[model samples]
Target: MLKRQKRSITTTLLTTLFICSLSITAHARRSGGPTPSITATPVVIEHIERNLSSLGSLKANQSINIAPQIGGRIVSLMIDDGHFVTQGETLLTLDSREQAAKVNEAKITVKDAERQLSYMVKLFEKRAVSQDELAAQEAQVERAKANLSSHMANLDYYTVTAPFDGVLGFNDLSTGAMITAGSNITTLDDLSTMKLYFELPENTFSEITTGTIIQATTDAYPDHPFTGTIDAINPRIDPVNLTFSARASLDNTNNQLRPGMLMRLNVVRPTIATLVVPARSVLFDGNDQYVYILDEEGLPQQRYIETGIILENKITITHGLAEGDYIVDKGVVKVTAGRPVKILSTEIAENHLDTVEPAGDARS
Candidate 1:
């Protein structure tokens, strides 16, 4: 019975040893196989831009409060609300009866003065009047002409005309309503283009210029983001806030935008040429950022890198990378440092990825 138990134990031990040896041989065989290929891309130069946000407001390109030039009772209202009117188009007509009668009276007086002046000229030529007497008659005619011109100019004041081409706002007053000089008649604004007002910190003022483009969104139309170009910058900076004001203009021929719309602006700083790589290639551990780059022998090596503003899924490599350096862009997680990798193929970048500039595009 002892011998049989011992034999059973020996058989079990021998079986375990055989299986272990077989497993080790299988692993060795698999390890000797070809190295797996990795997807790599060259670090290329790209223009990376930083984004900034600010709260702003929209305004009309040209806006004015329409008012009458003189006081009178309204006889006619030619203004059509919410419609565009050309410059010099009659907007309102006041009761011109008194003004017209005054103009006619002045005209008759001018004619009578001219007749007397002619008679005086004929008498002076015949030596029947002294030079001083004739000069006085000529002065009378001149005074009468001046008086007529004054009345005629005043007569034009009874009709209100537009200062420029613009769209009219609603007017509460109607015909026969009395208004004084400089009283509110309505509002007019040039809506062909809109002015966008915004402010930025003084630190970034160096990066901004007159042609810099700004993209904006309004709460009223969140989906429709519009764009404008910086046309003017206020030379004065806010003393307390340390910010400077800027103005941009955008096309608004359809009149979709108006004055005083709260807008959120997105300003892109000037782009700089720097080495860039795909965002997916980077891995973060603790606070250390790193990537797997291939050496000249196509061996995987772990490299630490510094990154900057990411635009359009491309990260700007501020450190630890240079243009033309090959890095694993796909299946980066599977790569092990110091491991050899086969050359599957290099991804030749045809065009650099970039953010589409919102300036000079068709109106939204």
Candidate 2:
């Protein structure tokens, strides 16, 4: 009986120990920390086309200032603001009575000198007049002709004409307004074809070329987008501003685009092949940028990267990362190196692997 009791005690102790061991294991599993939630984006090779945006103003390709070369009282204004005039069209007519009288007087003097010169030449030919006298008569005729031509030009200046085909501004001088020579009367701007001019930073000098497409917009017309090609570029950079001038030609047949209106320009630079990821995947610490990449075991590993400009809500990675990498967009803060991860959805995990794969390539 003692031997039986000893064997039974031994068996009971063994069983209790086994049960306790099982219970401890189960409790430890139950107390296992909660699984972390995370969001992720697959790294992919995308064409990274960058753009530089700037603000500019609309300007007419040509602008003309209407000013009289001769002083006179304004007799009439043939054109006003918003009036379209053709080239050589008379814009205004000034009082030219004085100029016309001067021209007539000069013409009479020229005719008298011509008659006197002819008489002197005939007398010289007949040996009745000295050669010196004939030369003096010829000089008098030339002087009178010059004076007449000057009066004729002054008379033409009295009648102001449009220098080019353009729209005129408001009349700066009204009838009976006394004006001096070179005084501005009105302005004419050619609006048929408008040009957009702007400056770019010196660093982007070599990247731009003629015929590069540019997109422009304005607050005045929110829905309309204007497209144009680079017409020209300044070869020399402005030392003070450290920029270069660029021009874009635009069509304005309807005359809707006016000069002095503000505009914004978007210039596309050269396209580059690079790896890109969602913007949320990037984290910055001071000047350093970093991301959480997955290791072979699906554990989070920190990667420091050099970044370029952001393109279309995606960050362009210049270095320290490559295509086919898996980055955690979310839940990165809770991750540590060498930690094990159990993927909740195998499809999501597989898709992440497939992200960088070219088309028609399957993920293993």
Which segments of candidate 2 are over 4 A away from where they belong?
A: 1-32, 236-242, 344-364
- Residues forming the 10-long window of minimal summed lDDT in candidate 1: 355-364
Tens-digit lDDT track for model 2 on 234-328? 99999999999999888887677999988888997778888898887788879999998877656668899998878667888889888877787
| Clashing residue pairs found in predicted model 1 | none
Candidate 2, pairs of clashing residues: 81-169
| TM-score, every prediction | 0.64, 0.81
What C-alpha lDDT do the candidate models reach, one value each?
Answer: 0.83, 0.81
The CA lDDT at 94 in model 2 is: 86
Q: Write the per-residue lDDT of candidate 1 for residues 32-72, one digit (tens) a residue.
A: 64344456788999866677889988889889998877999
Which ranges in model 1 have alpha carbons more than 4 Å from their true place? 1-46, 275-364
Model 1 local distance difference test score: 0.83
